[model samples]
Each structure stands twice: as C-alpha cells, then as structure tokens.
Target chain A: MGNSFFTPLSWNDTGFILTGVLNTVTISLVAIIVGTLLGLAVGFIRAEANRFTNILLGGVLDALRSVPLIIQLILFSTYVGAIGHPLDPFVTGSIVLSLYSMAFMSEVFRGGFESVHHSMATAARSLGMSYWQTVAYIRLPIGLRAVFPSWLGVALSVIKDSALVSVIGYMELLRTSEQLISRTQQPLEILIGVGLFYFIVSYPLSLYGRYIERKMAI
Target chain B: MEYEFHWIIVFQKLPQLLNGAFVTLHVSVLSMLIGITIAVLLAIMKMSKARIVSLPATLWVEIARNTPALFQIYMAYFGLGAFGIHLSPYAAVLSALVFVNAGYLTETFRGGFQAIPKTQYSASKSLGMNSVQIYRYIILPQMFRRIYHPMTNQFVWSILMSSLGILVGMDELSGETQRLQSLSFRTLEFFIVAAVMYFLITKLVLFSAALIARRVFRGDL
Candidate 1:
C-alpha cells in the first residue's frame, strides 16, 4: 500500500471514476423515478383522504423525513440481512434512498396539489367534468406545473443524498473517490473532482428550477 | 426469516450512545450559529452593488448549495489535510457544516431581506428613526420572522448531516452506535434505537420551534 503513497491521479483512474459516476446517476434515477411515483400517489391520497387517514400517512412519511438517511440505510441493510434476506448493496441502497426521497417528494406533491384553488375545482365541476376528469385535466396539469421548482429541488437533493448509499457499500461518486483517495493519497485533487462533478450536475438544474419558478410566477 | 431480538444489549449501552447524541447536537448547533453569522455577512456582501465584494460571496454560496454535504465534510477533513492543516474530526465536521449552512442560509437570508420592501425602510426613515433604530424596531424583526421556518429547516438539515461524523470516526451517535454494534454484534437493534433517537431529536426540535414561533410570531406563522 505504501508503494503508491503519492501517486498522482492519472487517466488510468478515469474508468474507476466513471463507474462511480454512473452508479451514482443510476441509483439516483431509480430513486427519483420510483420515489416520485410513490410520492405522487401518497400525496394525492393525502389530499383526497379523510383527516384521520392524512394523519396516519403523514406520520409515516414524517418518520422517513426525520431520520438521517445514513442511519436509515444502515438500519435497513442490517435489518434485511438479519431477517435472512441479504441483498446486494445496490438493491438495499435503492430501496432506502427511494423511500427517503419519497418522504420529501410527497410533501412537495401534496403542496402542489393543494396549491390549486378550490375555485378551480369548482369551475371544472360546473363544466360537468367528472371527479377524475377534473383531476386529470385541471388539477394534475396545473398543480404539477406549479410545483416544477419544488420537484426539482427534491430531485436535486436526492441526487446529492445518493452519496450516502456508500455507507451501505454501494460505491457512488463520493465513495468511489474515497477508495481512489486511499489508493492515490491525493485527497485534495480527488475531492475537488468529486465536488466539481456534483456541482456541475446540480448547478444548472438549480438555475433551471429558479428560471421556471420565475416564469410560473408571472 | 426468523431472527431473535437483542434489544437488551443495545439498551445496556444507552448512556454511551446518548453522550454521542449530545456531541451530534452540540456540533450541529454550534455549526448553525457560526453558519448563520457567516451567512449573514455573505448575504450582505452578495447584495452589495460592487462586483468585487459580491463575487466571492456568490461563489461561496453556489458551491455550498450545489455540492453534497458529504463532499463538504470530506473536503474539510481530508482536503484541508493535504495543505498540512490537520484538524480534529470534530473541527473538520464543524467547519464543513458551517460552510454549507452559511451557503444555504445566505440565499435564505437574501430572499428574506428582499421580501421586505424598500418602502418599509424609507417609511421608517421618514418616521424619524435612525438606521439602527429602524432595523432594530422594524426591519430586522420582520426579516427574521420571514426566514424563521427556513432557518429551522436548515438547522434540522445540519443535525441530520452531522451524522456524517460517523464516516470520519467521530463518535457522534451513529459512530458510537457503529462501535457498540460491532463490539456486541447487535447491529440491527443498535441502529433501530439510533434511528428512534434521531426521529425524537428532530421531532423535539420541530416541536420547540413551533412553540417558539408561536410566541415570537404571535400567531403570525
């Protein structure tokens, strides 16, 4: 190990870094897609359900939100193994990360759904639209459009939080860089690269979110 | 799928784990305080008319907001080490959390400040109030009230992120849980308790924040 104590980062490590980036992107996509579907469903239910149902669903989502994602990942992986179902890190990471993202996404979705004025729904009903028709035609399109910024915000965070899956040993960018840092012992260069990669991915999306938010405000 | 429970072993080490929780709370709260201080300054600078003053502020805010918190902590702990500035794990985590906190809070504070109309400032001046008196009596209070919820969310985020302390071998709650679980081989039980503790900690913070907001905002929030 000491033989390469000061090895400079070389192109040889690019494939390693690329793998990490791909893993990070892959897991993030899975979580965001799965989480959005779940959150969309749960958020809609919460919006339409009775007060008691809302409370129950809200409490479960609250637990997901309140705990740190790392702990959830660790607890989840260990619990699953203890229960005699030892899955791979990627699978475990996806499950926990998706649920975690879903917690925040549901809130965004709920707010989006509720942001539509009661007047809009009444207007649709007066036009003789059915309940689902009013929802699909008016509320879904308008409310989802209204929440583009928030949805982007949560999705971007899930991308960032995907790094925590490394705790469960699914090597994403940060963890991949970590392994490289140990091998190369060039923490500064590797870490800056990792930070830059995340910044590159996140910054433009954030700008887009803001731009749309401004557009929608008008 | 049959598994025997070992919660008793975890319960036996509760005090040790609680101490770690205190450290987690301590680091995050301290980071939040320092972060808010730096963020306020950064916000002011970003809003300055001069490019020279605002450029660095903008860079700092953007980098902080865009990068992952895990990256920030590692950069603090290990990245700075490459420059021969060896810091303790606690110091590194604190500095990183403070950096990100300041970054995000700068935007929040800036937004809060902008939300206050310039007319309010001019009207206060017309009321014969000096700048300090106007800020103290009118502008500052309202600005804080506007940003209070966002600030609370930042605090909670900091709390949750401080769990990254485990990675660098800082004996925060997660790290301590990891150590204890390794020793006792009760990983699931220990982590489950830690999860509960985190849930409780965040809930307590939100609960008290609500109480404080109720009093501070006087039903406004």
Candidate 2:
C-alpha cells in the first residue's frame, strides 16, 4: 500500500500542487477583503437606512442569500460566458465568492450593529455628534469588535468554499489534487494530503475564533 | 454585446428541472434525518468525561467543521473507491452530507444540552428515573425545543449544500442545469431558471419549517 501510493510522487509533483495553494489563498484574500468592505457598507445601509430602501435591499439580499454558493458560481460562470462577456474562471469564481460572502457578512454585520445599545447612540447624538461621526466613532468600533468572531467564521467559510472553484476548472488545490490522483492513481494519499492542507489553514482560524468568543464572553 | 435571450427553452425544460429539485430535496431530507440521530449521539459522547468516549467525537467535529464539504464529498466518492468501496453519486453525496451535518449539529446540540439546567436531571433522578429514563423523559424533549430553530436553519443548509452533488455527476438541480444548458446551448437562460428554482426551494423550506414549528411547539417553544 505504501509503495504504490508513495513511490511515484516527487517533490516536483508536490511543488505543482502547492501552486494551487497559492491561487486558493490569493482568491480567498481578495474575496474576504472586498466582500467584508462591501458587506459593511451594505450592512450599515440596511441598519440605518430609510424604511423603503431597507425593504427593497432586504428583499434583494435575502434572495441572494437563499441560493447555494455552488449554484451561484456555476450560474454566474456559465451566464457570463454565454452572454459573450466571457470571463476567466478565476474571475467568475472570485466574483461569486465575494458576492456570496457579502450576503452573509452583511447579515452578520447588521446583527452586530443592532446589538449595540440604543442608549449609546442617543448619548452620541446628545453630544451633537453627526450621524457619520457617531457611526465612525461610536457604533463601528464597538460593533466590529463584537462581531469579530462571526466575521472570522465567515472568512474561514470563504476559504473552505473556495474549493468549489475547481468545479469550474479553476486550478486550485482541490482540482490540482484531483489531477494528481488521476496521474498517480493514489487517491487516498493525495486526498488526505489535500484535506490536511485545508485543516492546517483553517484550524488556526477556528482556534482564534474560539479565543475571541471566550474573551468577549468575559 | 447583443445577445439573444431564450426564455422558451427554460419554460420547455421546466419539468426536468423540477425532477432535479425533488432529487435535491430527497438527498437533503434523508441526510438531515440520519444526521440528527447521529448528532445527538455525538453530542452525548462529547459530553462524557472518559477520554475514550469524548476524544473521537471531538476529533470528528474538529475535522468536519474545519474542512470544506466539497472535499468531504470528493473523499467519499473518490477516496473510498481507492479502498475498493464504490458508492453511487447519490449515496456519496448523502453520506458526505450526513457526516458534515452531524459534525455541525453535534456542537449545536451540545449547547442545547448545556442549556437545560442540571437541576432537571437531578429532579428526574430523585423521581426514581435511571440515566436512560432521565434523558428520554426529561432532557431530550427540552433539548429539541431549545435547538429547534437552529436545527431548521441547518436543514436549510443541507438543502443548499446538496447542490455540491453536481460535481460528482449527480443529476440534482445543478447537474440537470448543466446538462440541459450544454444540450440546448442556452446556458444563460437555463442557469438563471435554475438559480430561481433554488431560491424558491430554500424560501419554501424556511416558510414550511416556520409553519411546522408554530403547529408543533404551539405556545411552549
């Protein structure tokens, strides 16, 4: 078992696979950074906007949230390509990941904003702070700190979900592992390696999230 | 770019898409039922003081939560085959999802168990109930109530994640969409319709869960 699975593999083959890890990290970094920024903006709008706009945006965001990320990725990839606005798979994957992350992140951010006591906002107003000033100085710092764990959870999910880009033929870690398996016919070893790679990347984030939750509880 | 839109192909293919939706629902509901049963046991095991009892459950939840569901599905479908154990795409998706659903719900349910005051167990024991009776007659009912909403949310998650079955060539919603779009060359319309179908199914599941919760729990929950 060991000889068959382990013999044909060289460091060069492993190096090829590690390149997929680079793409995976790059895509996730872009998605998380852009998604969180957009999410915070949308969340702020949702939390503080007029009633009419809130209802409109809520309906749209909820619709986006309802569908699965894989479906969104496939649909977005195919739809854009068929419409003659052909995009590279990485572009489509990143766009879908960012959009999907934005939906959940917005909800998380909204919850964070809503959890802050209204009295704090009222006090800020009493001090003649402008709405923007109150948001920047009072609500954001407190709400962001409170939602850090939830945000971390979302970020971790984005990293994990980035694996689905392989479905669209984006040559990320999972896809690379799939190719490597076909070449080596050693599915067990290659997949375990892939899974362990993910675990290593994500487990620290999970631990940090638990740490943040513990600190916040105190 | 002037692109022609083909709404008619989507309307014509609605029946196939609906069949795929049923497949998606079947996989999700079955997985959730089995997953919850396993999750309850895992939660109990995790709460045990003995290392032999708790270690495995903790490791399962740790690995399951940190990894991607797609990887789990691939490993089940592809990795198991390496061991000469072949599973059909449907079976692979179901088993993988059951693993993941149980992993997530174990924590949710452990939290539920913790929410039940320790006094309830003592009270039940004082009434001459043994461990099994205390759990069955006292702990479980309240745990179910506490975790009902989150359980429903997980059900929705199961439904959504079943879309991953497409990668394994399972003829679920996304798979059917891919096949039909490639055949008709109506990629845009087919996928747009598929996305709408997914959106509707999820909303329906959420609404139905709410309705059932209202009826079953009545005023208590």
Candidate 3:
C-alpha cells in the first residue's frame, strides 16, 4: 500500500501537471471565446424578425444541444480526419467544445436579448440610430449584463465538461493525472489531487458567478 | 461512390442494442431515485443552522459539483480498488452517478426551499403543526412543485450523461453502438442512430415530467 496522508509531489511532476493545466485552460478559453461569439450570432439569428431564419437557427441549436458532447467529439474527429484535415486532438477537441458550448450559450444570450425592454430599442430607433446601431449601442450591452449570471453558469459548465476531451487522447489535466496514477499506482492521491486542481479552477468561477448575481440583484 | 449501406447490420444488432438501452435506463432511473433521496438529505443539512452539519455537506456538494462525472466514476471504480474496495463496473457507475446527481439536485431542491416565503413556515407553526407535519404537508409539496421543471431537466441530463458509463465497460446504449460501429465501420450511421435514440428518450422523459407537473400544479398553470 502507498503512503496515505503525505505522498510527496515532485516539482518535476508538478511541472508536467501544470502544463496539462495550461493546455486545459487554453482549450477552454479559446472555446469560450469562439463559442460565445457563435452563440451570440445564432441567438440573434433565432430572434430575427424573419420566421424562416428563426426556425433554421432554432433547429440548429436544438440539434446541437440534444446530442451528447462525447459523441459529438468523436463524430467531429472522424469527419475531419476523413476530410483529410486531420486536426490534432487539441484542435479537434477545441472545435467540438466550442460548438457544444455555443448551443448552451446561445440559450443564455437569447434569454438575455429577450430581457431587453422593447421600448428601449424603439427609443433608440426614434433617436435616428440605425438598426445595427440600436442593437450595438442600446440592446447588446444591457442584454449581456442581464444574462451575465446565466453566461457564468454556461462557462463553468464548459470548464467541467472540457474534461470529456481526455477521452479522445487530448492529454489535458485529467489525462495527465490518469497517466501519473497508472505509473505511480497511487490512485487515491492522484484522483484527489486532480479533484483539487478542478476545484481551484471552478471555485473561483462559482464565487464570481455569485458575485455577478449579487451585483445584478442590486 | 458505390458505398452500400447495410441496414442488415443494424437490424441484426437491434436486440443487443435494446438490451443495452434497458440497462442504461435502469441505471439512470435507479441512480436518480437514490440520488434525489441523498440530495434531499443534503439540502436539509445545508439548510441546517449547525456549522458542523452544514460544513461537511457544503464541502461534499462543492467537490462533487465542480468535478466531472467521468472523474468521479474513475475514482469510484479505480481509486476505491486501491483501498481494497472493489465495485463492479455497473456498481461504480451507479454510485458515481448518484454522487454527482445528488450534488446538483441538492442545489435544485435548496433553490425550491429558499423560494418558499418565511411567512409560510411561520404560518404552519402558528397552526400548531409540528416540524415533521410542516415539512411533510406544507414545505415538501410546494418545494416539489417549484423544483419539478428543474428536476425534469436534470433527469434528461442524467440520461445523456449516462453515456459516460460506456467508458467503464458498462454496455449501455453508447457502448453497444460503439461495438456495432466497429464491426460495421459505419460510424456516421451508428452515431446518428444513437443520437436519435437519446433524443427520443429525453423527449419521452420530458413529456412525462411535464404531464406530472401539469397534474400537480393545474391551478398555477
């Protein structure tokens, strides 16, 4: 049996783990940024005045949301490889994660956009602002703030769900910990350590989510 | 481009796939039932005024909620074996699902609990109802009503999340589909079928939950 309380973490090993952490964070951040933009566009498309456009965007979002992320990852990887693009696991995983996050984030932004008072948009238009300017100057800022809490929820979920990429050999934090545990045969220590790493990443976001909620409430 | 599609393989594997779907459904339903029980207890503990009780419950919820269900499953399956506690693959998946679901459900229930006005509890006390009576007759019913939609959403999520059980060799729907795909080498077909099955199951579960909610909260509707 291994030591229970104090299995030492070597600095060399910690460096490797930190690299995995960096990879995970980089993938998540890129996914979040791209996903949020795509989601905003889709959300606006769904909320567009044209009925056919609204249905098309709504259908796309529903299809994305209904499928499991792991399956989506595998499908994307296989299709990309078949097309000869042959992305590395990181790139493929980021694309999949971004697409997945876009579905949920679109819902969040849709709720946000809907919460913008109709009168405000009208007032902006009455002041001779173009349609684009009304949305950019008046609707988007307030709408995003209104949905900030929900966006935070989606962001936290994306961070946690990004762990699924390890299944496809992404070599992120979870995969690194799995490799370490297998080599060291210290499953508990490694699992707990990985859990702690996850906590460090997620707890701050959760606290910030609460802070946003409080600020919005005020 | 004369790629012949094989409906025969899908037909031949239907029985195995159905059996796997049954296992998936069984595990999800059982875990959800157990998880909700644990969640209710944890929610109550979280609401407790005592630091000792709330502290541990808070920690458990935070750890479970923040970590991926896949990791939790690995810990239950692989980590426990290091401590000489070995669970079957299905057992490990079930227990992990319960643990993870409990964390989310506790939050959902607590939200419901908080939504209840303090005056309602005070009024129950004023009517000379004991704590048990108040909880059973007053708080629980209303809490259930408020949490119904979220709980339904959670159930759908759990069903989809159960796909992870395939990683640990539980021959759930995803696992069976994966095997079929390997044999037939029809990746898109198998995945598209599996995705449709998942969508169907989720829609069925959501429809039933909506029906139940309508029955329970007809006046509110």
Candidates' C-alpha lDDT: 0.93, 0.90, 0.85
lDDT of 1 by residue, B1-221 (tens): 89898778888899999999999999999999999999999999999999999999999999998999999989989999888998898998999999999999999999999999999989999999999999999989999998999999999999999999989999899889999999989898898899999999999999999999999889976
Model 1 ranges with Cα > 4 A deviation: A1-6
TM-score of each model, paired residue for residue? 0.98, 0.94, 0.92
Across B125-181, the per-residue lDDT of candidate 2 in tens digits comes to 899999999989788888888899888888888988999988889999988888888
Show model 2 residue runs off by greater than 4 Å. A1-7, B123-138, B219-221
Which pairs clash in model 1? none
Calculate DockQ per candidate and list them: 0.89, 0.75, 0.53
| Tens-place lDDT digits, model 1, residues A110-176 | 9989999999999999999999999999999988988889999999999999998999899899998
Best by DockQ: 1
On lDDT, who's better, 1 or 3? Answer: 1
Fraction of native A-B contacts kept, per candidate: 0.91, 0.80, 0.53
What's the residue-level lDDT of A71 in candidate 2?
A: 75
User: Could you tell me the lDDT of residue A127 within candidate 1?
Assistant: 96
lDDT of 3 by residue, B1-221 (tens): 24345567776778988887788788899889999999999999999999999988898789887888888988998899888999888899889989988998999989999999999989999999999999999998898888888878877787888888767777888888888888888776676678777777877888888788788798684
Tens-digit lDDT track for model 3 on A112-205?
Answer: 8888889999999999999999899988999999988889889888988888898788988888888887677778988888888888888888
RMSD of 1: 1.3
Q: What value does the TM-score of chain B take for model 3?
A: 0.91
